[model samples]
Target chain A: MNEHVKPVELRKAFRLVNHGPTVLLSARNGSVDNVMAVAWCCGLDIDPPKLTVVVDTIAHTRSLIESSGVFVVQVPTVAQLELTREVGSRTLYKEPDKLRNSGVSICEMAGHDLPFVEGCSAWLACRLISEPHIQDAYDLFIAEVIAAWADDRVFRDGHWHFETAGPEWRSLHHVAGGHFYAIGEAFPADSNGG
Target chain B: MNEHVKPVELRKAFRLVNHGPTVLLSARNGSVDNVMAVAWCCGLDIDPPKLTVVVDTIAHTRSLIESSGVFVVQVPTVAQLELTREVGSRTLYKEPDKLRNSGVSICEMAGHDLPFVEGCSAWLACRLISEPHIQDAYDLFIAEVIAAWADDRVFRDGHWHFETAGPEWRSLHHVAGGHFYAIGEAFPADSNGG
Candidate 1:
């Protein structure tokens, strides 16, 4: 049986992206859907939860995200690196269902229409807040995270419990040259109790 | 004796920030200087190495960085968490030389007047590329990295060698609540030798 998890409050959703993990951006319009890897994204606002992500103007996923105004950002674990690279390099125009083609399983949550990769540790459903200047000038898209969710085993009560969780629960951080560093060694805040 | 490292070409300087590490933003306007921790940053362009960072309107570092038209971004290692938090929490208004107050060592690099924090894994000297719209809308500043250097022991030849390097060489990733995750396991791109 699949474990159930709750959606994080919109105000607190920025915490998920604040850590700067490389995410798999998923978008769908009508029957067409696609997923691409992105390392260039940051939290833009807190309340209503705005985020900025750079999606290349020529990318196949950009149009789908622009048209649908809704997309999902999935934080994948180290074991999913192969799948992440596959989806990242291939476009939806070339591969209609890259998720399935990459041999990765997908499931749709009860409330959100977008698909989340099964192996991902956390997911966020975002709605675009179009800023044409940023998009045209820097390929940056600002969006509000309407809904957010995460695997309870890894994230609960707004804190990551990577220590108790298995290694597969750790998020991936991308370096250059196609190399990636798995999130490691959690140290609690000095001000806050560990 | 301090090591003399060659400056990275401006075009390839973006690679320094391509991997998401929380950076220490140091700035100075005449005699006044300050430093703050910022995780909301990313590479805006490749050639000429333009990057963007969000600094709150209320921050003292904002005015200093703006007036100076120059700032240094230092990528700290895992061991520097205490120092990073010290610089992050204390405002320049409270203690102008927070670096000295906090007991963290600082050094000047290249032609940049601002002091870069010592013991950081990497450093970038930048000149502000003023963009009013995004700055007003998002508290973001676009800057071009004028000079870049890395501790060869940790980062060399366009890649981070965290594995071979000691724990002190590991880069930091900030999670919410003052928590951080160190850069962990690395995987090479191809199975065959390049």
Candidate 2:
């Protein structure tokens, strides 16, 4: 594990995805591992942290998640724009070298057998909750976050330091085909309000 | 109706919220109307657009949505940060004057009776797709967009022009407590990859 990768409290895990950045979902089935980008990931619950993600039926990574019953949701950075687009566009079923072609390297954390992308700002190890109906009808999957991690330089003390961190470390919010806006300008709301 | 609020094509409605900005959800039941800010609203599908939102059991807005089976999801801007915090923090059940105290003014469209929050960048009128199981167990609601609109200044021609619009028009992404990061720095990914 990278030295800057630190554990995030499960209660505070919702904050990792609360802002709605596009995320990388990676899973392994037997000796094969696959990765894909998802823009529909959302925070579902706070305690016993849960999140919702929409994985299309055609996505190869979706099958890996189903077979393993586990997957990793990692927050990719602005620096990974090209990588994000590639993973989202290509499929592992046709091209077995999709990961290598997309310039993706897999890393691992102790005690967790899932594959974690090498250069993301945060990681959430999730166990699928298995809502078969929604999964069949809408391609929507729900999962409970068993553990979480983040790069301390960008996120620490249970909060994101985007205002202070380098712009390259910012999260990517996808708009349309190949277009994205990096997160910017952090400020506290007026004290008189919430 | 505001002159700038033009109807958005149903196929393109998902783009209005694909970036994951914190949104204002409004609904009316009988003579009662209520609004709340949600960070969990996410795009669920493309054609005949659909969305999912996690509305807690205690929310006054949730009850209104359940009774009416309709609601409006509007993308609040950086300029509405204070209003967003106030509405999310105050409750319509306990304080009858929540809307007025929170500085929320209700506006309307030609055919829809729902309360639309003024000064928002985009709006999507939705009819609830009630999934009782998820609502009871997860506080989650799914809906199909019935109609959509956006301020031409910020969103038009089937795309979001945040890069050219004034900073105030940028969407707000909530982090925690009163903290938020405004959408920023629009750029295109390398075309060769995707």
Candidate 3:
């Protein structure tokens, strides 16, 4: 693990994804590790932070999550645009070398035995909270973020410093197809308003 | 309705929120109308487009959604930062004049009876898909977008033109508190890679 990869306080874990960036979902069932890009992830709660991510039935990563009951949601950066597109478009089901073909390098955290992508700005180690109804009906999976980490270079003090970070460090938000927009300028509202 | 407000095809309605921008959710029950800011809305399914939003139990708008069973999810622009913060932080339960105090102007679509917020870039009139389990446990509400519209100036032909649109027209992605990031530069992935 990189020195900058530090554990994010579980309470502030929602901040990792509060901005709504396209995330790379990675999981390991046993010997198999798979990763895929997901744009439907959203923050669900604050304390003991929880989130929801939609995984299609076709995604190989979803099966790993179903079996292992754990997964990692990591935010990819603008520098990984091609990598994000590659992993998102190719399925491990058909392509045996999906991870290698997508140019993804699997890394590990200190305590969790989940697959975390190498260069993402932030990661949330999530334990699947099974809700079969929505999972079967909507393909939406809800999970509690048991542990979280972020590259302190971009996120620290419970906030994202995208304004000061280099352009490549900015998070990617997918619009459609291969089209995406990097998170933009900080616009802070008047403190008195809120 | 502004002449620029045009209908979005149901299949492409997910595009309105695909990039995960903070949205203003409005609901109407009889003569009562309420609008609240939501940072948790996300695209769920494409065909007969569905979405999920987390409205805390304390929100006065949640009751309106419960009674009406329909609400509007509209994308807030960088221009509405203060308005978003106001509605998001203040509740109608305490401040009966929440909408007016937040500087929110309620508008309506031609066919739908739901309340819509003005000066937003896109709007999706949604019919709540009753899911009592998640709603009570997670404060998550699932809805099917029945009617959708976008300001053609910023969104047209099923894509966002944030790179070309004015800075104020860009979608707002909330970080925490009143802090936000407007959608930024277009980062299209290589077609060959995907």
Candidate 4:
């Protein structure tokens, strides 16, 4: 296990992606590997901690996941904003050493062959749930998380502790083009006991 | 057309749900109607602006939507936090007037039979694309945006302008229980000539 990365409970894994952060999706097929930023991702189930993410049909990471049936999802923090945008803004079609170009370094994840980004706030090792129709038609992929991890400084007790962390710990929420929103403060709603 | 809500170009409609907010999914069948907060939603296509959302099979809104074959996707802002949480916490299985119970008021959209929340940041009147396999298995639904609307104060000229608007225009991204992170400041990332 990497010193900075800590394991997150599988059941609590959904909270990792729950706050709508733009994530780095990495997939390795044999020796070939690819990492790309995906803005459209969300938690689908709680106990098993399933997730749904839209991978562009033409993206290199999409083909890798399709071929290998596995991928890793990692949430990038505000400090890596430029790196996240760079990864998402370009295609890995014929580019070699794409990860280096995006300034992303991979760390070894236990029991997973995929290369997980070193500085991401959280990571999820996923086995793709095969749904060819949607994969072909909508570029939407669903996966069940088998392993999860989070940076202890930002996430503990199954909740995001962003208040104590500095601004760099904040998650990124992209709007369009190169513009992104840093996730703001967390608050609880007063429902008047509804 | 409602004075506050105006038409959004279909091509730019993806911006409505681009930042990954939990939105109100509303549907009507015969005289029965339902509204529920769904956190799992994202834009699938850009030109025609299609969307894929997960509506739990047991949800009343799901049944109404499946029967009617149409629905509305409305983005609730920070001002609607309690209402969003209230609507998501309860089910309309046997209870009557669920919308009123959640303190949400409805306004009609043109050419649609459904009611959209009056103060929402944006609205997308959708026609279901009808992919049954995934719908049955994943509780996922894909739809084409027949029409889109956005509150002028928050969204304009093909982008979200949350900076100028008050917190009422800030979109809600739910984490779990009653916790949510209001979308914060927007910034542009500099690319290294990729």
TM-scores for every candidate against the unseen true structure: 0.93, 0.97, 0.97, 0.95
lDDT of 4 by residue, B84-185 (tens): 887998888866877898898877765789978878889999999999888887788889999998988889887888878986678888888888888887
Which model, 1 or 3, shows the larger lDDT? 3
Candidate 4 chain B worst ten-residue window by lDDT:
B185-194
lDDT of 4: 0.84
- Give me the displacement of residue B34 in model 2, in angstroms: 0.3
lDDT of 4 at B69: 92
Sorted into a CAPRI-style docking class, model 1 comes out as medium
DockQ of the candidate models in sequence? 0.51, 0.59, 0.61, 0.53
Error of 3 at A138 (Å): 1.0
TM-score, chain B, each candidate: 0.92, 0.96, 0.96, 0.94
lDDT of 3 by residue, B77-189 (tens): 87888888889899888888989999999887777888889999999999999999999999999999998999999999988888888888988899987889888888765
Clashes in predicted model 4:
0
Stronger candidate by lDDT (1 vs 4):
4
lDDT of 2 at A136: 95
Off by over 4 Å in 2: A190-194, B189-194
Determine which window of 10 residues in candidate 3 chain A has minimal summed lDDT: A185-194
The sequence of per-residue lDDT tens digits that candidate 4 reaches over residues A1-194 is 45756888998898888777888999998887788988888777888789998998779998899889999999989889878987887777867866788798877865788978888889899999998878888788899999999998888888888878888888888878888888875676544212
Interface RMSD of 3: 3.6
User: Which residue pairs does candidate 3 place in steric collision?
Assistant: none
